[model samples]
Target chain A: MAASNIDPAIFEQLQAKIDEEGRIKDELKDIIQQLEKQGRVTQSILSRIHNTPTGQLGPAVFQPCERSILTQIHLVKVLSDIASKHPFYKWNNLWTREMQNLIFCLQLRHWLAHQELETIEQVGNELGVPINVKDRDIFHLTIEEYLLALTNTIDELTRLAPNAVTLGDFSRPLQISKFIKDIHAGFQLLNLKNDTLRRRSDGIKYAVKKVEDVVYDLSLRGLLPKQRSSDDTPAEAKGGAGAPASDMDSDVFLEG
Target chain B: MQMAGMKRSRDGPKPQGRADWDSPYIPMFENFRAELDEHHDRREKIIKASRDITASSKKIIFALQRVRNLGEKIPPPLIKSKEYSQHTSTIHERFVSVAPDLKGINAYRYQRQISPGIQEFMEAVLFRHYLETQSILSPSESAKLISENVLLTEDDYVLGLFDMTGELMRYAITQMATNGELPASRTGGRGNILTGLQDLRTKLEALDVSGSYGLSKNAEQKMSTTRTSVEKVENAVYSMTVRGKERPKGWNPGMDTSRPVGEVEG
Candidate 1:
């Protein structure tokens, strides 16, 4: 044993490393806070989707939604710029929830206009970023992030199905129903782990069933466009705000 | 799985002039399925490798514990033996095998899957370094043990250092019991196990990682555990001193005989 068994400089260096990590997190947190603020405004703008009619959705919802999403896109670039300098997962927790929210906004806006789930590539294209990067140590939307966002978009559209019918756009509910079922079916293809993404995705079945109920209610009243109907008992449709309570109606969602 | 073959004829003519399919996103999902599967497979590889690395590291620590003295090579019988060789090689092989999966961006991507092994390895390496040199293992020295493809974050390193303190405490207790004295220099210098433990405690206590993320979040529990370890050694040393006069002739509380103490730290 030497007079100095442990060097003082060792702890000093460790402290320096700890402080450096703290500094990086603070800088990233500053940008994430800005992203979070922008994300909120974008969400407030997009929430207007519920009241706006299908025909008026373009000028009323799409225009404002796209503008807000563009602002969030800029903050995302700033977040990504600083984040790229460090390991992706080191500070991913600081921004992942907000990033997922931003992705959901993009997916929702794209879906409203095009009536198709925005591909991860389309999401990256609109944000001016890379999608599902495999090799590079750069900022990109991961597949898990994209899938989580897509599931969130499906949840949003689930709320929209019945709203579209409430606004007398009888056909919009049918479109949303098909789209949500498609996305839910997409989720079924994934072999998910028991994590946050899996839990969020697991709820997609409920979203599927909810949208199915809206469609079933519409078709029962002869409100369907007279094509490809899965008939439900009119008596059962009168109860339960289009809940998939009966095994018969749930079978429609399962098989479809 | 096949895309549902059912017709999309019922959904009001497919809202956007897009060609209707029962599920239009199948091609997109097929791509996602492949990507996710690759991610999971890579994740599983790291996880299994991590498990082996962790188990081997624990065994290495156990083997190192058999040595009775500090500031020297692990005795030939304890470390140069076949069992020690197996643990060291197992750790090396597992680390090398998992390095490619942890390369570049994926290093941090699969950190959750791989971090447990790295932390345990750090503890073993740090303990060995302390036992051999009676000095702290710098982060750079630790970096040499880990592969270049793997990223070792400061959080893992600090947490590993925290765990190493418990090993030191155990070593001190065992030494005091076997040798009828605290593990210290024959010259009675301050560079003994208790001083080293207190020095470590002071440094760890001074750290200010208060946030709810990374090291700070885990530091709370580990810090308390570290505190308990130091106190255990302190209490054992205190009892030995208070009870020294009452012991039977040549009777040791933790030792059967006092061997020739190592001459160190004049």
Candidate 2:
């Protein structure tokens, strides 16, 4: 309104800011690639169990998993600084690819370490990044990015469902079903407007159905454990269970 | 949530040598790591290429600005010169070289990251073309030169055009301020930049951009920005004609036409 003036000082400040962002953005690319590498390494823990005897995975697998988790936590700290500082805005793209990659790492590690999905607030706390930093905090991943990562993790879990059955872990199918449903409910609570987010959120139902079908198939074959069916196991209860139940096969009733 | 059970397994005995669990996943892990490494390298190359495109495109915009003070008619030799072709071709070549990389990465996945460079390139090239030719560069025309056989989405084209309007507004204002008046139309009456701005506004306003998800809202916001830019140019032109009448002929508003003589010390 005031004669379209371009102040030289303000322009120089903007150039400096862009330069800083460029440096950080390049650094984030490297960090995201590392996070993905660590995620794949952590994922090997699940795959290793598939090749070995169901009850014989011993404590060795924990070594790599722990290393991967530690590296990811470090990366998430760096990612949080960038995300909370330079998040989506007028000059910048709001939803960042780097944040999505970081979210994937955070979710993958939590799922492997705790066997449970991590809530956004829980993740924020773990990374020392606060979600309630008012508007445009670039250091924190937005709820939408978290939901996208959750959808990707569900896809990863769906891939693992068959391996669980092969390992004679029928209870895992039920656990996955419950886990995915809880995540689906979390997504339903958010008011999504981005077309991609809406479409991906719609996909949660399919994942829920896929996991349910696995449970249904196991149940129809009478492979399910004789647990208290009248009472539903809360998701957090099973997720927090220490160690894979090596005696899970004993719980299954085999029919001749 | 058995805390004791968790602790026990976490601190369990280490496996001895020749443990076979790692064998099954070792190759798979190596393959995944290799793929990630390749992707990282490819992205770095793309970023470099996009930066090259931005720098060259800015030079092209600077070249276009060189013609502003010359006159309404851009020299025919300059329009067809090797220099112009080289700048435009550099963009085409850069994009073409990165076509495979962009395909593998999926452009939309990194759209927000790479979009500033792409949009800036668009603004520069499109502004240059508009200067040479009085018409706005259509999406297809821009795509042909810069998209490198890979079609840029309509949304990206529209977004690029949104910024181009700002460039046009600035060019018009600078021309009027430094040259004493806007460039005359072909019939030698109204300014050509004014007509170009009006035409661009009308064309952008008539489009049905509602079908694009997430873009419609952005389109509304950009429309307001484009409107403001147009008004600024119009205001500058208004002041030049109505307010500069009292000044002598050939008096540029921004330049020092009549410097005050310093007093000589005896």
Candidate 3:
């Protein structure tokens, strides 16, 4: 078969899409920076509250007013951009979907950074379970069991994104779903080691006496088998044993 | 009898080269041939199944390619600002018209005269400023502070509170943009900025600056005093104008109420 031809128009369109996506990505970095600055402002507010006289204010006074301000500011900015960029209702749905996805990413990143493997696994399992098989036998049964457990969990989580406005298209990639499941399985395997009995056993002390005895026996006997069949017969007689005795005698007499 | 005799003459002698029917090897040879036929049948079935799978996969790939082609033909949604700049311009004009007179209006007096919506916007701005500078209190400690100092109900205050926060985020973005950091948040949703701000606040709370610095009491006192002064500046910017007959109806002390503070004046 001949190779297919590429369409220039399609290529150009795809290139344009990529360029736009790149611009957005660059813009996102700036947005993150803005968020960081807003966060600093909130932190300053929080510090002030922390330093305030205890008797003067209630415990709820430190609920991060500045942080809330920053959050509101971020929201308004986003809204303004959306209002400017999108038609009234159309942008709302897109924004909601984007926000939900962003929040999920943030949560996932948080769990990953803290080494919270169990939580990560739980989230992944709740989304979908991926199965990975290895050559080792000891891990076989447990891995299979965890995979089954994860499958059940993911079935439940798959239902969650569909209903959420913000989580639109989250389940578009089957590969990603499977990857998440596999991550869960990996986390479960990591946790499984904590309960393994092989880790607890000290085989060295238990087998020491038997090992010494085997060593002593080996030293005395030098690893030889019992006597050989050749020891029973003279070397010359053995050669003639395969032939008839009379024939052998005649040959011998002739030779003499 | 003559016809039968003729038939026997023609068929009487079997061909010398032909294999005997009674030979034992004939049955074994037949069995082997039958087995070979069965093996060929199985092989054919496997090939057919593999071909079917390949064809199905090819069909799927073709369908995907078609979808991709169609997607390329579709244009991206038009950006809202670019498409509807006129609407924003109108809103901007409105804000400019009202801003000058806003300074002369006292919070209480303005609340009585202007539409409830406009007054609400102003109050929200003040509260947002208070929150941004931590002039009021910590979010954690605010319920107690609210009980003592602030007289407004939670329901009445929430909108203004969120508005103020949104304003502050806008200010932050503007400052950053002025510094050539990045463009402001386009959505103006408030929620996204709030979440980001909260996350930052949490990180700051975890810092062990006190343990690292290890300052004496006098030095600590001095530092506290300096912090307090900076906080007061933030508070002054955030507070609402005091109303009096002699002082214009909305005399905002921070800056000229007629001019938008952050805009680059030509």
Best by lDDT: 1
TM-score of each: 0.86, 0.47, 0.18
Candidate 3, residue A206: Cα displacement in angstroms equals 40
**Candidate 1 C-alpha lDDT tens digits along B41-118:** 999999999999999999999888877777776777877688888999998898889898888888888898899999
**Model 3 agreement with the true structure over A95-130: per-residue lDDT tens digits:** 333232323332332322231223323433432322
**Worst 10-residue stretch by lDDT in candidate 3 chain B?**
B65-74
**TM-score-sorted candidate list, best first:** 1, 2, 3
Chain B TM-score, one value per candidate, order as shown:
0.84, 0.74, 0.21
What is the i-RMS of every prediction?
A: 5.2, 17.6, 36.1
Q: Write the per-residue lDDT of candidate 1 for residues A52-79, one digit (tens) a residue.
A: 8666667787787677787888888898
Whole-model lDDT per candidate: 0.76, 0.58, 0.30
The 10-residue segment of model 2 chain B with minimum total lDDT is: B8-17
DockQ computed for model 3 against the true two-chain complex using alpha carbons: 0.01
lDDT of 2 at A213: 67
Task: Give every collision pair in model 1.
Answer: B177-B254, B177-B255, B178-B254
Chain A TM-score, cand. 1 = 0.85
